[model samples]
Target: MSLVYAKNDWYAIAAADEMTLGQQRQTLLLGTPLTVTATDEGVVVRDDQGKTYPYQIKFDHVWTALGDAPRALFDIPEGDEPGRRCVPCGVVRVKCSPLRAVENFLDIAHFPFVHTDILGAEPHTEVEPYKVEIREEQDEVWATKVRFFQPKAAKSAGSGITTEYEYRVPAPTVAVLYKTCPPKPEAQDVIAIFVQPRGEEECDVWPWMALYDDESSFEELVQFQQEIFLQDRSILENQLPHRLPLDPKMEIPTRADMTSVAYRRWLKKRGALYGAMTEVA
Candidate 1:
């Protein structure tokens, strides 16, 4: 099996919680083994060759690159706002391509079937038309005007409501979603998925959130988000071919897949080949 990751981009290598003093851990990234150590100066990551790479801690994870990154890390404006709880939902390692995992996040039609009554239920599986465009300036894909009915959109949600949704793909292996906040209808909640590719068919996914929820405990928030992803993990790991097909003809798409189409195109246009199927079978 031959897989090529986008070498000129940033990826999350470790979580902040794992950087306890005097602690050391080993993990793989793009098929390379690295040693992660926590020291007085902060966490340091070095490869088997003893060469250490520069890293930064952001959104509760350690970000690094195997090659010289061509672009700066994307920002999360909602994360800087006041009164919003910042919850880093931790890591979920899956036996699937990082691209497939991301495409799954940008999908809403599966909520009723995969997430069940929590995110959606029977007779409410219809996904409204959404506007999708690629921001040429930033080379990002965005989808707007999305609306869906949810049984329980958030832990703070008391009942079902029509949720307003917007999706953004600022990076190939990362996706951000803006949805109606149950606690504050005027503002939206931000949920981002940052995937760290261990290889072509495996990855570590870090889910982070910036929300207006004050009622749900931190533990409850983590559990709720993890549960949602665990539900997705079932489909992610079992999907045929494992990697995401960038070719539109490989898998038929409906109107509800507008954002996914844009995402695949953006990936292709940018030449981000990590965990992507570029050729027809």
Candidate 2:
């Protein structure tokens, strides 16, 4: 497994509301210990050696890069849409590679087995053919036209429906999913999963959502999202080899794994070795 992390990228280190003035918290990103402090100026992140790094507050989180950043954080224009609730679902720590966490977020074939009635159910386990591509203009991976049957697709969903989905990987450790919204059938609910690599085989995942829901309370929405991801945590931690394999030869990829394949290819092309195993014995 390659322990080299692509440092030239922004990673969500802490939720905005979690950081208070004059408070300091210790966290890890890309296996580097960091001291995060909230000040009048803004949130400041420092390495163990007391070297301060550049930081930005966006999407209700503090993002920082430990190396020379290639660009700023990816934009989510939908968050500013009218009548949408931007919910920060909080962080989930898992004993697995961050790359694995992001890949799992992009998967729909496991919905029936892992998420059950919430995201999928038995007898409707098929993952229809989807369009996967690498947009050279933005240098990101996108999977569209993905459809799947779900019993309770969202917190506002009143009945089972076939959810149309679009998955986007803007960064190595970040993935965004756009799925059908029950309340607003014309619009889609946005769920973004940002992972912080605490170690080569461990990470803390932050899930943020923007939904057009007027029925569910804030607490109810958070609980629903948390329950769904907690179920996934079990499967992620139990997977063999912990680190994700970048080589297709290391693990067979079926038709349903097209998104995963594209993701691996994107990572390999960019030479992202952190939390990636190029070969398996």
Candidate 3:
């Protein structure tokens, strides 16, 4: 019998800061050499020649990393129309690697299980699907818009948290995003975007930004969220064969694996699937 294995997460190779204009970097996306460049106009990426390409805009406070490379932040042109428009979204483009980790992490279905130490510790919790909107300009790499919502009774452990998670994945390395304003005045809200490698084994993380509009203090709220991610790293980094292999029956997933499973399905459909798909071999 033959079993095909895939990865459940995506690996980030470099950040915006590590790339230079007209320079090329090697990446592991589908075991392919993905090249990125910073140009006078913005950022352009090519695979195996001038074919399959897209250009991005450069702006201030923009940072990114690619496959074990250093991080780089760029300066945007003054009064530049395109640059100005692209800055708020935080990213102009991104390349979904073989891991499909980006979509997996965001799949609300797994929150209660995979994140048992954090969001999943409580009972009867689930993420409600909100909306997904996408827009791609002519000759653009890929532009995606996503929205997420949590109902009032969704978070049993924490207080009722309701807001939209918006994202614009402009490049394989950039994400522009923000959170919608909460209807209630006393609630806390955060708008943020994160681009990091699947695990410590990979390289740079893109510009990670967290913007807040609510009045609740940012101290504990930020720390709480940060700790959750850190916890994920601690566990994910220690697993055997950190990167996904093609053999399906190498590992075992327990009851807490629901989130991982759902995320895997999400990425497979997006064409960025990765990780070992096994039932405790």
Candidate 4:
């Protein structure tokens, strides 16, 4: 895939706690070297030549962009809801395209194979038809009515149960999953995946979750989310081509891949070529 980083959107670089007073951290996004530091005023971000860029602190992370941002960060209303545990499950670095990481998060077919009994089991390997669409008003891709059987849908689950899911792709490298919460049957557990494209072939993924469980400790909640994402890391790193192919002819899509297909179309429509492949001339 040819690399063409999207510069006009907010990308989460580091956890808020990672940047403390008098501390400085350096990272790369879309091949651009970035320097982050904490000052008396607030967090500051600059480029290699000391050119400062605009940034904001939200959802427990430092977000910045390389070019003019057309909009603010995507909102997660659940983050502000009382009694919900807003947990940040550290970052996981993978040697794959950021698009691939987001696609994997939107896929439930892999649950039976990659996630095993925790997310799915044999005999329930079938992925029932779901709805996928590009919302013109919001300019985002949405997948709804997705259902799956999970032995442990969340850390607070006591037994296996059927989990309903809704996936939203608001950006090229970001996706959020809303799934059934056993403890709070009326509400859904929100899991958001934010990918920072370190390069065309590599990325650092940050996982955040808002759960209704008050029974689990903070450490346990983080560990539970980490365990699930780490399992996906292995599978993502081993996929051939490294970059995601935007052309449908490059890979076959089945009923289960509706979300992924819609995502590729969304990216292509916006000319987002970062970590993406186009037809060779």
> Which digits, one per residue and each the tens of the lDDT, describe model 2 over residues 1-281?
23333677888989998899998879998888999999998888999788989998878888998876446678989989989999999988999999999999998999999888889999899988999999988989999999999999999999999999999999899999999999888999999998988988999999999999999999999999999999999889999888898878888899999999999999998888798888775
Tell me the tens digit of each residue's lDDT in model 3 across 116-163.
534443454544434443332311122123233333311122343444
Write model 1 residue lDDT over 1-281, tens digit each, in one string. Answer: 12333765778887888788989978888888988899999888899999887788888788887775446888888898999999999889999999999999999999999988899999998988889999999788999999999999999999998889999998889999999998788999999999989988999999999999878899999999999999999889999888788887899989998888889888887778878888797
* Clash count, one per candidate: 0, 0, 42, 0
**lDDT at position 231, candidate 4:** 93
| TM-score against truth, every candidate | 0.96, 0.97, 0.41, 0.96
Residue 56 accuracy (lDDT) in model 4: 87
For model 2 the local lDDT of residue 107 reads 89
lDDT of 2: 0.90
Q: Root-mean-square deviation of each candidate, in angstroms?
A: 1.7, 1.4, 10.3, 1.6
lDDT of 4: 0.88
Stretches of candidate 1 off by over 4 Å are 1-5
Which residue segments of model 3 deviate by more than 4 Å?
1-101, 113-121, 129-158, 166-168, 173-180, 183-201, 214-222, 238-241, 244-281
The deviation in Å at residue 171 for candidate 1 is 0.7
Writing each residue's lDDT as its tens digit, candidate 4 over 122-238 gives 878888888999999888899999988888889999989989999999888899999999999999999998999999889999999999999999999999889989999988999
